[model samples]
Target: MELKGIHHVSAITAKAKDNYHFYTEILGMRLVKKTINQDDPSVYHLFYADEAGNPGTDLTFFEIPNAGTTYQGKGSISGTSLRVPSDSALEFWEKRLSDYNVDHGGITRQGERNVINFRDPEGQRLTLISDETNQGVKGGRVWDHSSVPAEKGIIGLGPAKLTVQDPAPTVKVLTELLTFKQTGSYPSSFKGNEDIIVFETGEGGTGAEVHLEVRNDLPKERPGRGSVHHVAFRVDNEEELAQWRDRLQTARVPNSGLVDRFYFKSLYFREPNGILFELATDGPGFATDEDMNHLGESLALPPLFEHRREEIEANLKPLDI
Candidate 1:
């Protein structure tokens, strides 16, 4: 009943066009799925991933043009990091951000890894990191259609930073409930140089890492644009997913009760710090609906919402991608 690495990081974006351009045009990620939010058909639920829309490579957004900027504080997902291939990949990204006038910082050491930090157009905190084991190894699903070359393209998700005021309780949930082991502690300049505890899922490299930032002084966050809706951890198949649900119930943790998201099965529950966590399966991938060559070319709807496709389409703002 071990969890795999991060399946995806879903965040909020008020500006659909800006979010689309920043991720696809500037950052050069492939828009693998163009779908409406199943919970709210009025807004778009866009998925950006590697070439083939692999589970670990996906980074998604919920479009809410009127949603205000997020209030950053405790109990929020502070940062979403992307995995790059090498130190040279970081150099390429630094020049790429400069060329586009994107505000970013030079490469810095985060423990044993090198990270190039930046934000999306909507001020969503993001980073690109390369560890020694993953450096120079070309990733599994490098997008050929991306503006950035396949070699240097962002491969997948790295460590996601969660800001929690109380670390001990949250750490207990991570260790006991989720089965994440604390790998090490590193100094976090974001939390006034406080030590950030790093936890891992036993396998995978950068995608398996989760950093918990302990800062009691930070206030609670009000969710809006640039805030993470939830962080999903991967399970291998239906068998593994069922086992996870059983464990959650046994531990007295309330969950979303096995939701079928069409692309994957999900069970959502909030952790001790009130940050939303999801257990997502890795099969029935993005290509389940559309062909591999034309994954996000058109909007796809789930069966429940399929009857009102025209109505949903009318409500959603047109994306120029």
Candidate 2:
């Protein structure tokens, strides 16, 4: 199949306000859209990403206000890494983290790149690296809160790193179905890990490497805070999406029926290796809400939510964005 690239990564957040502030103020990601979780309208579903809020650029969150702390185990998404321009950017980011009293650690080199690892307010593990070669799509940074300067903020996605219980099945899916290529493997200097496998989608750089770290000792993951919600891959349109659905069915991979996700259509299923995966269509994008220029400033909903806007707005806790 001809996968365009990543669509978005969805994750769970315990509190709406904390997640909002972390993505907007600290990470410097724009709050592209805010609405209720379609599956459960009582909770908020927030998206953060580059300007345009393009598919591959987004990192979405589902706010389950009353959920308990997430247990970090095996079989769940380990962390997400964002790529910046150069190693120099890490110094600026380090200072920014310190300035905001957000805890972070020193740089550790990974193959050709140097990565800085940190955690969100909700304890989701995140990393930033400097990859000058693939400086992600150029755009403006939104959410100019005092904590994070507009410059040196996140430009776009880097790559999502997953620590799997057994990397074999996952590796098969990547190469055979998803069309990912095995880039190479590297030794990890980070504590408690040995080797990491790097997979590239498109001529790899930022937002391209899907790193898999194999740790046989760890127990399987139990999703909660600090765990990845789901990772989505892009399909050209409904036609291609249906093709992917048929492919999954032929392979006997369990899948969720086609569903409307407002901006795009999507199919959800667990990979043979257990990661939650979604195949989504590419159009009727963020522009569907407000004009492309005015996205994220106000509440935008899918057609289903538009009729309930008043009720959703009233139920959601007020956010300053």
Candidate 3:
């Protein structure tokens, strides 16, 4: 019943056009899916991933022009780290980010890895880590459409950093309830953050791990653009998804039961620290609705929204990806 790895990390974006350009043209990821937000159909929910749109490769954003920058504090997904192929790949990205005038910091040591931290157009914290020593997730194809060469293009997710007041409760949820094993720890470079404790599940590396940073003095953050809505973990199939639901029940953690997300089945819940977490199945993926070669080319709606497609499409802003 162990979770495999990250299914995807979803965040909010203030500008759909700018977000699309930053992710597709600048970051060089494939726009795997372009759909409207199910809860609020007016905005777009855009998914960016590696060439094949593999489970761990997804980094999605919900367009909400009115939602401004998030208020930073504890109980939020502080940053997302991406895995690149090698040191040379990191160098390539450094030059690319600089050429585009994207604010970024030089590579810094974090335990055994070197990380180049940066922010998106919307101010979402992002990091790029070199996978030169094969320390990152292995699956997922290099994107062919990226302006950046395939060899140096981003591969998959790296560490997911979570900020919390006290890690004890979340630690219990992660280790005792969810089965993540504590792997290592690294002193956080952030001023007020304590040492970050690393936790891993499945074949560990990159997307298979979460880094917990304790910041007891900070206030709770409000959700907005640049805020992570939720962090989803990968499950192999329906059986594994059911097992996780049962485990949540046994542990007395209330969760959203078996949501049919069309692309993937999902169950959402809040971890002890109030950071939203989801268990999502990997199959019936992004390509389930559209042709792989032409994904994200047009708007996609679920069965419930299909009948009102024209109305929905008219309301949503045009995305020229």
Candidate 4:
């Protein structure tokens, strides 16, 4: 069975308070889930998305207090994109980002669409991609309560860019192992570099594509405050997820087996280049524990972690947002 588009992109953030404010207040994306990183219960794991926290809409962050700045380079999920409604939405975001004093490289054409590349306060690389010409997998609905108007609000996720030294192995993992179709290539913005290759999956469009850029010049990424931890692709359900587990075994690709993330089931594996990739099922979503109208108002813990909620809550610094 084919995998769906990008499920979510998880990154690191040193300041949960500021991170919460930036995403919810400035970017205007809704805080869909407030929880702790399951692997490291001491830190916070925050999820921001559309009103419903749909599978393809989430952009999450793990809080690591006082982490160092990321030295961005190769072998990394270089940039994460958020889908907005139309080309005109880019004009709105350009003005909005400026008004908020956010650091950004103004709107420019990337491949076929107009995109605005920018960084969060923690130097998290992000892009606002206009879905004006997007086809295939459609985006999620906007949060009606967002500070940004419904028409201009961020809708869902777009492409997650993978920057690596060589494209062959990574390409093989995506094309051969994951079944992504190499759609096309685009001219590199970097001088002396090869054109970026495009790979597509379910329904194939901006929402369901990966843009691979080969950069032999940059060093291997040293992750800290703003580095991407991993990027997860969406699978339909647990039965399919089990089959995928078997497939990975057959292919001899080591994986995390099957994991219950409470909100979703997942299988995590790194490619030959060492960039983390996860295949996650899209069920038992964020609303599993919280009321939809009041999501992110308080902390949420998985059922297994529920027993230690008090201890977990005590360890986390009280987040303002």
- The best candidate by TM-score is 4
- Candidate 3: count of backbone clashes, pairs at least 3 residues apart or interchain: 0
Q: In candidate 3, residue 301 scores what lDDT?
A: 89
Superior candidate under TM-score, 2 versus 4: 4
- Estimate the TM-score of every prediction: 0.96, 0.92, 0.97, 0.98
Of the candidates numbered 3 and 4, which has the greater TM-score value?
4
| Shift of residue 74 alpha carbon in model 3, Å | 0.2
For model 1, residues 214-251, the per-residue Cα lDDT tens digits are 88876899888988999999888878888888999999
Model 3 spans > 4 angstroms off: 191-193
Could you give candidate 2's per-residue lDDT for residues 1-321 as a string of tens digits? 666667788899887888887887777787888877999887888888877777677889898877777777767778887656567778898887888887678687777778788888778888887665554333234444424454566666677777787788999988887768887888865577777898877445556567888887778777776668888877779987888889888988888978888888999998666888888887778778687666677777778767888878888887763
Residues forming the 10-long window of minimal summed lDDT in candidate 4:
312-321
Q: Among all windows of ten consecutive residues in candidate 1, which has the lowest summed lDDT?
A: 131-140
Backbone clash pairs for candidate 4 read none
Error of 1 at 186 (Å): 1.2
**In every candidate, how many clashes are there?**
0, 3, 0, 0
Clash pairs of candidate 1?
Answer: none
Order candidates by TM-score, high to low.
Answer: 4, 3, 1, 2
RMSD of each: 1.8, 2.4, 1.3, 0.9
